[model samples]
Target chain A: MSVHVAPLKTYIYVFLALMFFTVLTVGVAFVNFAHHAPKGIGNVLNDAVAMSIALTKAVLVVAFFMHVKGSTKITPVVIWGTLIFMVILFVFTGADYLTRPMTTFVPVMSQ
Target chain B: MSENSTLAHHFDSYAQQKESASLGMWVFISQEIMFFGGLFLAYTIYRWRFPEAFAYSSNELDIGLGLFNTIVLIGSSLTMALAVRNAALGEKNGTVRNLILTMLLGSVFLVVKGFEYAHKWQHHLIPGPNFQFSGPDPVHAQLFFVLYFSMTGLHALHMIVGLGILAWLTAQAAKGRFTPENHNYVEGVGLYWHFVDIIWIFLFPLLYLFGRHHLT
Candidate 1:
């Protein structure tokens, strides 16, 4: 098998993009849309936005910096497999917490 | 048919040897994901249980320093990528240069993290009996710091290991041991370094930016 070398420019581009996304994540955090929408939904939207940008940056690093885009056939299988299991773990565990009934853990001392 | 001495005896070709080594590294990384995944799961459970406290606790962290470290790690990943690129192209000096830069950036990250940790210590944010927070639920806030220290501490350990690998790679590059035809060692380390960076990519937002909307 032959080696596929990524050009220098690609790495530079990815570096810049990652930096941009990093700043973008911070920038998004300071912007609040809670006044326009329901408070709970707005907060969730903000968290989702931040995480989505992070996911994009992770993909760029994996595909380009780590050479996953040009990697051997078996490599992506491992990458995808790891990702699937991670999702399963988080999703399964999150289901219990997200579905749990709300309870007041602190009892009022004066009530 | 081992053209390269680095090639193992059981391998049929240099390419096969390289491929297997790369795969082994990825498998190891996958295991690492599971390792860190457990911590993330714990974080999620606690955040779900005490969202308000988690949000307030996250705001107590210094975003400026967190952002700075993110850039530093990203810069290191770029240098690591360049090191691999130069190694694969048989550019000896370029490989050495990038390897040194990567190591420097990695060290800078650790130093900044050390200072951050020290700040936490001074403020008694170490999440124990003396822990202090002005947040509504100090117990839940302490839980946030517990996750914070464990996750970032684990990530820092990986950076240290990565620095050691880069140091070894720098020495090897200085010796002109890698060539366009045989630089799987460099490539393998590149994968490890990038995987570390990816962990921080997720970590930066989760640890620092997750509930930051409360700041505004």
Candidate 2:
């Protein structure tokens, strides 16, 4: 009985939990991180915090709804193949986007 | 005389057919995730360069609607899962009922999303010539809305496809084509539905509601 099939009902709880965290993360973001920062570090801190929670919610979805948790060897192997392929794609595309300079005309600069 | 040879003649048992179906569906899902990964990475890079623009623009999105859609999608995912379970357990009527519910919920998601997009379009919140964003970085703001439209619009397309599949599956269920012994088709579609929900889970917060509170 190690299959440990995920039940449909449990997803309700997961959904609620993600909601709670999303709201909480958003709420925390509005607390004026500058007040807690040295000078201009507040925005960075706030972004970091918000991203952390966002990442957590993403992980929850991957693990649960996708049912990747407690998966077998073959399933993980297939997933790894997909992950590796996606990584290659991301790296190449990112290289292109990164190398290209922002060439759009800036209104203020043009003025 | 036992002619349920929707199974390939080479395959001996229905279990193999079911397993293959599951594996194939998973591969499809992996491809989908990778497709979305492109946009996710784009979002990441843009946010990295224009953190302030991204943060400020997010403030304009309706977080409450975003939250509502998230819950609705999750609820539909649950129904999709139940549909699969019912199919796998040889409950034809239950499977059809659940698939119907799932499809209905999907339609609702599209309706809500349509309203949101129309709102943006009407207000010229979209990011082209005549776009109206007073943010410090209009380009960055436009980038967010671009990502927003591309991502959610693609997701909405998937939901439409998923709804079509569910309708067909419901028809098959009504005909008693599915049995507890062979319902991988239902399970496979269920996986797709769940994947769609999972995407929304990230998107609800990321594309729409993220960083909104920070600006407030």
Candidate 3:
């Protein structure tokens, strides 16, 4: 089978995009998303934005730099399966943690 | 079947062999994702539990250096991609040059990380008996540092391993061991390198960029 060698320009373009996203994530960090929204909601928004940019960068590296875009069909299947499991790991664990009641115990000395 | 000396007898053609290799590499990478995924899940849960402590501890980290290393790692990924391309094109010298460049960037990242770790050490933030945090919640803050060191430490270990592979690839590349149709090793290493970079891509934001707006 003939290998599909990506053009030199494609790597350059993807590199530039990754760099741009890196800077954008940093810049977004300094912004007070909380001030624009309710106190708690603002913090959530900040984290959401930061994670979104990171996910974008990860996708770019996986697709172009790692050549997943040009790889065999089975490759994506493996990746997606891994991702599904990861989601389960996070969601189920997070659900348990978020639902647990906060209880503090105080020990008393006998008189 | 193709009579290519590099082609394994179990494969019918070079293409099938290459596909199998790529699939194997992806499978390995998927397991790696799960390995790191556990740590990420722990991080998410703890950060959710102690947002203030996590943010406070995160603020203590040097974002400037973190950002610099992020760029350096991404730059290395580019060189690694170029190296794979060169190897696939049967350009031995180009492959070696790009691989060496990638190693240089990877080393720079490690050096910066070493400095960061040392800084944390000197500041009494290594999360041990001597660990100290001036924040309101020192215990929770220490938990953040625990996750910080573990996650980034694992990532650094991966970088060191990737560098070792690149060094070997460079030696082989210099000896003209790779050709256009027989560069599966180079491509596999490239995927590993890029996977490491992707881990850092998520790690930088989660660890260093947490609650920066509060500091501002």
Top of the candidates by lDDT: 3
Between prediction 1 and prediction 2, the one with superior TM-score is: 1
Docking class of 1: medium
Q: In model 3, what is the error at residue B124, expressed in angstroms?
A: 0.5
Model 3 chain A lowest lDDT segment of ten: A102-111
Candidate 3 differs from the real structure by a C-alpha RMSD in angstroms, to one decimal, of 3.1
Q: DockQ for candidate 2, please give it.
A: 0.35
DockQ of each: 0.58, 0.35, 0.58
Better of 1 and 2 by DockQ: 1
Q: Candidate 1, residues A88-110: lDDT per residue as tens digits?
A: 99998788767877565432321
Model 3, TM vs. native? 0.95
- For model 2, state the Cα shift of residue B96 in Å: 1.3
User: Per-residue lDDT of B37-103 in model 3, one digit per residue for the tens?
Assistant: 9999989888887888898999999999999999999999999999999999999899999999999
Best by TM-score: 3
lDDT score, residue A42, model 3?
73
True contacts kept of 3: 0.88
Tens-place lDDT per residue, model 3, A1-111, is 466888999999999999999999999999988889976677689889998999999999888888789777898899999999999999898888778974522212111
